[model samples]
Target: MEYLIPFNRPFLTGKENEFVNEVFRTRNLSGNGPFTKKSQAFFENRFGFGKCLLTTSCTDALEMAAILIDIKPGDEVIVPSYTFVSSANPFILRGAKIVFIDSKNNHPSLDENQIESLITKKTKAIVVVHYAGTACNMELVMSIAAKYKLYVIEDAAQAIANNYSFSDKSKKFLGSFGHLATFSFHETKNISSGEGGLLVINDKTLVERAEIIWEKGTNRNAFFKGIVDKYNWVDVGSSFLPSELIAALLYSQLQSLDEIQKKRIAIWNQYKNGLKEWALLNDVEISYIPEYSGNNAHIFYLIFNTSEKRDNLILKLKNKGILSVFHYLSLHKSPYYKDKHDGRELVNSDRYSDCLLRLPLFVDLTEKEVTHIINIIVN
Candidate 1:
């Protein structure tokens, strides 16, 4: 029997060990250390983001975004039903009502065209997740938000370093367009720090408050910069920062972003080429990359003709030693949210939940392994 090929695995290159060793030598493993500052600076400079705050996980960043926005009970936040629960969980935790929207027919992002119809007087914000590292139509979403005076929070968990281009040839990095954005550095992502994430604040007005909330409602960030003589609790908040050890690991990953991305893109292209014939013959559809968007090849998922075929394919792939998987179950259909659903049917989201399957994609997957996996699927 062959060795088991895991679904997703982290890849480390460059200075991970050296940086981590440096952290240990310094004896300062807590947050807001030298590495943390360096990592934050790296994000701001490379991604053209206004500000960046490293956190324990993408969930923590989203929670921070929720608190920064002051989400209140009865306030509604529009989000896609096709994303991980963490995307919507923060708003729910804040007692804000969730308005689940469907995805576009060809992609796993919130259908921007359907957004306007869902907006109401109670809608305070719109959360757009860049599913599988493919960006949503930010221009349209931003336009709608501006017209309705709503805030836009980007759940960019899977979109670190992903770039998007517009029809007019203009381009923007995924995390730069939103009022606030969140990124993940979990082991499952392209980058890994065991468990970590970052929050990017594009709205200058929210920067100071975000830092306060990040430091457990204290103006310690200010105090540290000599702007304040002392720090004390000034608002309701929590500790969202990660230790310098995690920052050290992430910095290593960030330093090699280009090389890691190149390898992943190669694997993504191999899968597409290898599966094209099988997909066509089976009447299935593969993922599409819009001309206006440059994806990071973060994930490669295919859509089968029916839910039954998708399930059978998973079993077949597993039997053949290829471990493929499905994605999020629509949030609106979950027991926790069923009663809360606003009676709107998210048809596209349901379709995605039923039919999509993610193939093995990661930085370290060898060409021969990829070929073997593709052969199993194609056969």
Candidate 2:
């Protein structure tokens, strides 16, 4: 048998070792160092975000966003049922009621058309996850948010370097549109820092509070910058920042973002092309990338005709020494949220939970490996 191909893996290139060695030489491995500052600056300058903070993980970033928004008990936050649990867990931890919405047909993102009906008097925010680096209908989501006067938090975990273009010639990065957005540099993401993430703040009002929360409720960030005489407890918060070492690793990935993105896109396209005929024959659906969106090709998934077929495909792949996987069991149906679920059936979300299968697509995967994986699926 061939070497088992895993679903996704991180690739280290360029300055990974160089930066890590620099951090070691400097002996400043704690939060907020030269690498952290450089990483924050890179994101702010390249993505046009108001501010960026490197966090321990995307989960921490979401929690920071929840803290900034003051998600009190009974506050309702609308989110897609098809996303990772971290997207909604932060709000839940803060005592907010999660209003889970279904995905749109043919896509893993929340249905913008359905968002309005789910909003009630308690709706404080809308959490939109850019599933697989593809953009959601932000225009519709933004309009609904404006009408309701709610905060929009983007879970752009898979969307680093991805952009959404508008007809008016304006282009916005995935993390740029939301009041606050979170990104992951987990080992599985396009960029990796072993286990790291970032929080991008787009709203000026939230920046100061966000920093305080990021620094464990203290005004330490201000003190460090000489903006304050001493740092002390100012509000409720947690330790959200990662060590300088992680930032150093991520800075290396950021330097080669363009090259990584190009290679990933090529792999994604190869899968799409290889499976096109099989998909058509089986009446299955392939992931769609809208023209207005620039995807990072962070993931490549296919939807089978039925849940049974999806399961069989997984078994087949595993037997063949290929480790394909499924993503996101609908949060509404999970044990934690089932009792709290709103009395609505998430049709599209359920469909996605049952039918989607992610193939092996990684930065280090070779053309031959991709062809082999696709051949297994097609056959």
Candidate 3:
């Protein structure tokens, strides 16, 4: 059942092995070693993030953020219903109640206008996912959070190496605007360490505590920084850091990010241009890019008029040895959360749950192969 074209293939920058070998030579495979520092510095210097720490996965980073923010039972956190489970799961684990936000009609990001109405006295935070690397309206989101005095965490797992335009014609990285942000370097993401995550602390006040939470609730980082003579457990935390080996591989990936993004954007453009006419004729919806968001090319998805058409198309592509797949189901309607939902329908989230289809998108996917995929889909 091996499809000639898989849904995703992790790209290698060729320097990964060399970097990992260097880590082995340093004889420090532990977390927060030389390789980890190099990787973290790369992000901080490149994105101007306040402070960055690598974690085992994005979920762990979010969990650390949850702890830093002091989430408590009965506290409410607003999250988009069309995102991966990790976006809400971390808050839920801290006993915070999740208030699901609906997606925008023509885009997968949460409707920023609806965020204000969902806040309450008990609301503690708003978690925004920059779906497909396109930003949610950061200006409005931050303003609302200020008005309500709520925390904002950007689940920028797919948003690395991308920019968000401001209303003043200024721009910044997607992960920079939120008080705390998390990113993934999963094999399928634009960047890869196979299994790694990052937490960016934009709020200066949270920086010191975030480091404590990252080191399993200890002042271990302070000790290393020579700020403390002795380090001991001081708070609740977990083993959130990834091994130095993962960071080594990631540093290599970071070195080639521009090259990788260039190729990915080209692939996304091919899909858009190739399918434009076919989409209009078939009454289907192709990828949508908001003017304020950079096209990071994290995904190029299609939406059929009905789930049947999307499913049938996936099956058809499979028959041709091409792998195509559906994206997230609405979290509010999921079996685990169905009863927990407030009975309010999130129409756009539900629509994407059924109609959205993701095609093969990887660095190795060539122009000829893309054309072939387009030809099959159209005919």
Best by the lDDT measure: 3
Model 3 ranges off by over 4 Å: none
User: Each model's TM-score, in the order given?
Assistant: 0.98, 0.98, 0.99
What RMSD value applies to candidate 2?
A: 1.3
Worst 10 residues of 1 by lDDT: 1-10
- Please provide, for model 1 over 92-166, each residue's C-alpha lDDT reduced to its tens digit, 9 standing for 90 to 100: 999999999999988989999998999999999999999999888888989999999999999999998888888
Worst 10 residues of 3 by lDDT: 161-170
| Colliding residue pairs in candidate 2 | none
> What are the Cα lDDT values of the candidates?
0.92, 0.92, 0.94
Off by over 4 Å in 1: 1-3
Best-to-worst order by lDDT is: 3, 1, 2
Of the two candidates 1 and 3, the one with more favorable TM-score, higher being better, is 3
Error at 373, model 2, angstroms: 1.4
Task: Residues 11-102, candidate 3: write the lDDT tens digits.
Answer: 99999889999988888999999889988999999999989999999999999999999999999999999999999999999998999999
Cα error, candidate 3, residue 308 (Å): 0.7
lDDT of 2 at 198: 96
Candidate 2 clashes: the total is 0
Q: Write the per-residue lDDT of candidate 2 for residues 239-289, one digit (tens) a residue.
A: 899999999999999999999999999999999999888999998899799
